[model samples]
Target: MTKAYDLARDAYAAWGVDTEAALAALSAIAISVHCWQGDDVGGFERKSGTSGGGIQATGNHPGRARTPDELRADLDFAFSQIPGRHRLNLHAFYLDSADNPDRDQIEYRHFTPWVDWARDRGLGLDFNPTFFAHAKADDNLTLSHPDPGIRDFWIEHGRRSRDIAARIGAALDSPCVNNIWVPDGYKDTPVDRMAARQRLWASLDAMLAPAHDPAHLLDAVESKLFGIGVEACTVGSHEFYMGYAARRDIALCLDMGHFHPTESVADKLSAVALSISNLLLHVSRPMRWDSDHVVLLNDDLLAMAQELVFAGLLGRTRIGLDFFDATISRTAAWVTGVRNMQKALLRALLLPQAHLKTAEEQLDFTARLLWTEEVKDLPHGAVWAEFCARHEVPAGTALISSLNAYQQKVAARG
Candidate 1:
């Protein structure tokens, strides 16, 4: 069973206007305003090319797909749904357009514009560049995608994107980033140059390590199962750390919804903890191999949360509510879901740290019982355990469940 999503951590009523509420919600929370609707990191209005709302044929499509103003508007709504006052780690993946790189990637034309917007609102920044060389390099050949216009992300832009972060002053400081799931892995025996693909990120880390600043931020590697031959930017199910550690402050970006139904969340966390930075968690009734970032805690609440927590990922972990909205009213649904998560986090924070330690390290009990004991779970578990437990709930299940129940009451009203 998967983990039950905790939206209550996101939606509890603000205790007061003080910065404490904001600080409590800040590090543990952030969102990809656009991923709610697939990977249109630009949040562009999607219409057929024939339709006027579609991306227009232009030299630069800053306003063609979506405007910077529209993006800011979405975040404003996001901040409201999040519990208490907080900051943001914005995604600008749409900026990497065929026609324009800077405007489409992490910018809306000029760096100062985005900087001004965040500074005005007091939110921090995180974004990717269109030209970063992250794609699997096909220097000698051109590849065809089952889906048209989808560039070979691993070959073309993987390194370019990484390079931009090194060069850009702003990107270096943003709290977090999302690495595109480069679908370049070869299902066949003779693959494209694997060494080159590996080198792309390695070089990036080697170059940036000297310049990396903890204050500048970390990178989150988003993994995937299908799309491009099951071979994506994440490297593979195991050697995840090899690719991630290449970039300074970089970590694995786990999307709860990204794995196949068979893949256990607990197992995934255990296998990939060495590289984890933040979680791009998704929740929803899943289809076969499809990604639906919805709110589906009730489907299997206990198992989901338990696995996530067992893997040492829960409280104090940065969360991005990846939800989609078909209409403006859906914004309420998305926001409500986020609120539920925040409320659940509160319960997790209250969990006793010492008791969890014994069960997890000494007793070697199940992840479920590790936190249920009288004492709290300590922050330091065995290195191997830490590798697996990415969402360690600081607070206990009771607090999280109670707060979540309260939010359910609120959801019932709407």
Candidate 2:
């Protein structure tokens, strides 16, 4: 492995790319792993009847975490196989509450255990207010609901969510990214789109009225093109959130799966970064629609990583995984998604960006094209294996056997 890595290192150095610097940089970037993948998004909150979120996980794979302890244990095993230190992204519904409080009534005390869990592991935390899969969201409107009571209920929930996030960040000594994504829209065309958007703007203003220290909390608004039922129109459209984020001077979250099939989120990164100070990225795979499939080493993912590197926005971007695939081993899904994201970043770092830029600047398009294709065949796998070895994680197909052993010994117990 050392011999292969040395060869690859020399090769990369020939292109003026420092493999050591790349590794060090990659080690510092932490990807936020979502907690819902372990439980199919059925949060710990005790609810009656069916889930009402616009989102849905299709599979009923065995070994789903039944409790917070089990989920944490599963995450422990998953994180062990993945390289680099990562943060955990949590929804409010995942609270460790015995009293089963309503969403609007949730408080910081309910999530202290999670803060302790993250602190113990030396991990940072990110949060989201659960605006879906609840009784209040049954009508498919929240924060933008015409009813003052429903709107007020979600508003309080959002406010408390921000406060809870601040507390968690203060406890962990890291700024928590509190992202708001409301599943409010219509199944068909609405007569009054202006009214719904206007109401949503007001709700957001009220929710964000409370002042919190920027050092401890960063607020972001996420937009979706559509969801399962809200097909025709989504109140929190991309334009709405972009305008809001700019006007409010807050971070705007762009989910890779939350755009049209033809749209490249990679292309939007540079444009949005010009206006927004910070950006939150929910990395997920979209099959046709926003199916939220497990992320893979695909073209779009590669392009996104390259864009970040080219734009010099890697430091300002908050990357988080947002897929929930219950068809496979949950822990394996976590490891694969997180590792692939890291891999994409590593590939981008290994590129000969300087050479490519010089060629383009000199009007040598052919040379630029040649260099791009040439780097594609480089020994990136060897460098990646060396990276895994340095990080003390299973490299190559060894991760497969480790996951199998885990499923048999640990997950099977659940």
Per-candidate RMSD vs. true structure? 11.5, 1.1
- Backbone clash count, each prediction separately: 84, 1
Model 2, position 402, has a per-residue lDDT of 96
Please write out the lDDT profile of model 1 over residues 1-414, one tens digit for every residue.
Answer: 112212222222221122223334333544433332322333332221121111111122111214555445545654543544344443444332334442223323434455566677666555443322223222211122322133333233434444444334354345445344433344444444465445545434433434344445445555445333332332333355335543444556555555676666545555555554444444443456534444543433334444455466654244555544343233344455554554344334434444565556765687536336421232212211221123332234433454454334333321
Q: Give me the candidate number with maximum TM-score.
A: 2
Cα error, residue 388 of model 2, in Å, equals 0.9
* Sliding window of 10 residues with minimal summed lDDT for model 1: 48-57
Judged by whole-model lDDT over C-alpha atoms, candidate 2 comes out at 0.92
Off by over 4 Å in 1: 1-66, 87-89, 93-111, 129-174, 178-180, 185-212, 228-249, 274-286, 298-317, 323-330, 350-414
Which pairs, if any, clash in model 2?
53-133
lDDT of 2 by residue, 198-219 (tens): 9999999999999999999999
TM-score of 1: 0.56
Cα misplacement distance, residue 363 of candidate 2 (Å): 2.3
Candidate models: Cα lDDT each: 0.41, 0.92
Regions of candidate 2 where Cα sits further than 4 Å from its true position? 49-51, 410-414
